[model samples]
Target: MQPDNSQPKTKPKIASSTTDPVDFDHAIGPDTSTPDGRREIRRATAASAMGNMTEWFDYGVYAVAVTYISFHFFPTEGGTLMALGTFALSFLVRPIGGLVWGPLGDKLGRKHVLALTIVMMSLSTFLIGVLPTFEQVGILAPVLLVLLRMVQGFSTGGEYGGAATFMAEYAPDKKRGFLGSFLEFGTLGGFALGTAVMLLLQVGLGDEAMMAWGWRVPFMLALPMGLIGWYLRNKLEDTPVFQELEERGEVQQHSSLASLIRGYWRPMLVMSGLVIALNVVNYTLLSYMPTYLEGQLELDPQASLMVILIGEVAMMAVIPFAGSLSDKVGRKPLWIGSLVGLFVLALPLFWLMGRSFPLAILGFAILGLLYIPQLATITATFPAMFPSHVRFAGFAVTYNVATAIFGGTAAIVNEGVIDASGFLLFPAVYMMAACLIGLLATRYMPETAGASLRGTAVPDAHDTGILADADA
Candidate 1:
């Protein structure tokens, strides 16, 4: 799973097409890139990781601390509804964020814009921590809260697409999956850090005290990220792949919507299924799991958090390994294997979470491992499915659109199903269906992990072999 020193280091040549340019040696850039463009990948991955971590960290903290904030911000009678509504509404804006951010990343450089976004997110988060309540200021309080969330939404929309595209461009021809997966690790790391901090506060200060003041701590913590994100991104250079597109005047400029319609639309459609399968399985198991276990399964909230915390720890270690292995063994096999395992395992393990603490922990650990497919490969592969001009637009819009539909609704839907069905098995059915759809998609689409980011989509067999050979 570690970078395979045993494999031949030859670079695979992509097919020639009007759209596809001839392979070029690494040209001069602020970052030192290797002959085949490996250094750019490393720098891109590092910078992108910082961006992704902060984006998810702020969002995760908001979700974890929402109940606490609702207690302070909304009317007592309607607080829960207002809280859930606020969270859902924030997600509703993500697609719009993707739309606005994508073409900009494609047009302007990713580094400058992403830095601006970090500053917006940090300020918004800090303001949330210090904001006044409706009890003191009336309905205006909730309105102001919603407004702040919109700004956060707009900022994150750009952060994700830009970061993902940035990493994809720099990834080495053979090692894209492993290297790009560091971005996923950053996401998981941020979420884990945020959730762990929330839970630590819950354990340290009980819910009563937490709702009173402790919840504000996590939101306020984001203020420091402004300095950190800006610092990390300061020395980074533009992605070489992107730089090439900029020089050639191939970067998309109209709108993310126009780019998606012109030539990049099909890849966006492909990613729709991809995101559905991914978000359904991931959110069902992660974001919804803690509440599901504590509420439905009648376990301790702290215990459920601890279980997921352990699972997240396992994920931190396995993601890079899985990405690296996909570089050698091929992405399709890993994708199919993980899905099949989850298909078989979902029902039984979810049931066990309702039965005992240890079983719940074990079940979640396996679920975390299953996510290595996404954590390691998607960043490298999905953007490679589009031309450099549309890669940002294609990858971000499709992902955010699908996520808007499925990911944001996960907690509400799963809780609703459990509320209605009285059976824990329904979520398992959802998982099975998602994994199946994902499995079928891989069989049809060729692997693109860590290959040239600007390759043509829908290639024939020989080109497919070229893509497979290019994967790291």
Candidate 2:
């Protein structure tokens, strides 16, 4: 079939709520203007954000405490590197988790999967706190630690995709970007909170006490956090979009895998490609910055945690502004600007980070600012790439696969690159490369700001059912 010339290139028209047979926003709770609506929105937002908080809190503690974990979990020689390696190990199974949980999310409902993931993550994280040390358990200690991390990775694979989908579907279209920012806020908030807790503990307890038992306290905190997230999620209704699909009898009976494979290859590739930059920046700054500061630059461990804590707090403040701005200008503009900014500034930031405390904080803060556009808008952007039926699976599989390969291994890869080449700032080079890939991917995506969650179907020759379901 020849391509139709009737469709608009830049802005694709999608089915609006008024014209659609079903109201996607119904049963999502009270109106946005009413008291009940405001309370429901707050509860829904917390439900979504807390899951992100739980996942990142564990990650933040692990990354910040890698040095201590290294001494206790692995051999003395290269123990830190091994600890970092263990950190990366958990991500290896994320794709598998995505495959299992993503389709289940699409098949069942986003709320149930989210509740399950929190439980899995919380149990694994809490168990790590009580695990025997290398001195006490011999080789079994590291083995058990790796096993627990694998479980964490598996659960997290499903957590983020579902959270983003649920939040976007529940939000008002005009304010999706603004409200979506809360999810990322929870992300940075969790990391900042975890880092702050560790920093205070380190300051008060001293290294010896922290290494002995203080670290376990933070890990143990995951139990209560996860329980709160689970309760919030259980109290909420399923997303308006998913509910609408079900009501309209448009919910797919086939597996999300089949639907994705049959029609969503391009979007899957594009989403994965964009994630390259987003996650490399995420893991690099959020996950690896402390390691780089303390291990490579030889900054004080407590000071390094403090720098990251401050940077994350700053990033959290700016994320909603960036997300709200994207709603006005377009998701593509912010993404393009940030990719270019990171490409240009990655090297300079690293250079400044090596200088002194003030410059290091300044450098990290700048990098975090540049990174905000991507992190802030991702929840608003990626879920819009696919139709409601396969949104969870499509986002989960592609995001986790790319994250597993690039994001999870960022620290290890940077360490190896610098080690082999004798260049300290190779991470800057890596970040730039990832940004370039993301830039290319973003250009191909339709401008989706304020677009319907169920996209506008173009009566064109190139219409693939699933892709058209996502609209432009």
Candidate 3:
């Protein structure tokens, strides 16, 4: 059947609220005044940003600290390949962790999932700091290290989805995108902090001390931050959309794989695609760039991470503007624009940056700034796709699947390509490809920025039952 061109699309009758649906002036909580409205958005959004920064700190420390750990973990001079290889392999476990806990977030609550991940991450990180080295514990030491790394990867996989979902849900209808982007802000902020901490350690410690003890400090110190995040996540109220679903008996009682497949499968596919570019860029810029700078340019590891920190600071500033722009214009174009820009410039930007420190920082700042559009939009994008009942789970699983495939493998693929082909440009090409996929996907997905958080159950003009129910 050819798509209909004759019948004009009729929009639904929306209930009128005083505030503009596209711009959140005063739409959330009991606060209608500007001060109160901004306060609510800030307070709720802070949790996501806070949690994200802390967790990324954990992961970033791993990457930056790899230099310190190679000797201790592998101890054999000829086995650097084997050491980094094993460390990289732990990333594959991220998808499983995401797949396992993501659904629970959908069925249970974002806050619950967020809190759980904080605890798991904190415990694992602290234990990793204290784990016996291969020198003392024999072969089992590295094996245990891999196991703990898996736990950390798993926790990280859940962390973003829950935090993003929570922020999106709490954001007022007009400012959902702006609010949701804070999740990434938190994430990148954490990334910066981790790099900065490692930088500080390097400045103060000798090479021997760094390899011995300074490497452990970053992970061990996370205990207090994780506890603080857990408290904030637990104390926060659930999103208004999720609350409405619960009151209406709309929440799915079980998070069974079959149940999610039965109901939210379409969203699973759409969201996975919708959020992939950001996930790809997110990892490419945040995680892979570190090794790229340190390995390729032969820059000081400390200086390289510090340069990246400046880029992250730019990222933090750009996120809110992009998100707020989405509120004013819409989510789709902003997202597509970012992807398209990346497709066009990723190769040059990455290539130039890899050549010089000053140029590298400049390249990163530009890439990170343009990439902010995805960070701003996707936080609100996924939640808007599903009904409150299944929004949490649907968003979490799909987001994780995309991240696992594209995001988790970013560093691995970039490094592998660089290693195998002796071409340093693959990371840029890889980023471009992911963005192109996202550009196409964003074109067909429905617009939901101003749509009600509770889904409309009426089917589209076509007589598909599930689409009809989603509309209702």
Highest TM-score model number: 2
- Give me the runs in candidate 2 sitting further than 4 Å from their true place: 1-30, 256-259, 455-472
Could you give candidate 2's per-residue lDDT for residues 146-242 as a string of tens digits? 9999999999899999999899888866677899999999999889988998999999998889989999888889989999999999999888777
Off by over 4 Å in 1: 1-20, 25-43, 74-82, 255-259, 454-472
Question: How far is each candidate from the true structure, as Cα RMSD in Å?
Answer: 4.7, 5.1, 6.6
Which of the two candidates, 2 or 3, achieves a greater TM-score against the reference?
Answer: 2
Please, what are the lDDT tens digits per residue for candidate 1 over residues 244-272? 76766666556537636666565677677
Compare the candidates by lDDT and give the number of the best one.
Answer: 2
Model 3 / residue 195 / CA error / Å: 0.6
* lDDT tens per residue, model 3, 1-472: 1223354444342222233222212233535357866676676777777787778877777767766666778777634455455545556666676677777775676778888898888888888889888889888888888888888878877887678768767776656777777787777777888888888888889667888788899989788888888877776777765665455455556666677667767767777776677777887788777777887668888778888889988888888888877766667778878888889999899888877778988999999888888876777777677655556566666776677677767777777778789898888888888887887788676666644454323113232122233335
Worst 10 residues of 2 by lDDT: 458-467
Worst ten-residue run, lDDT, model 1? 455-464
User: What's the TM-score of each model vs. the native?
Assistant: 0.87, 0.91, 0.86
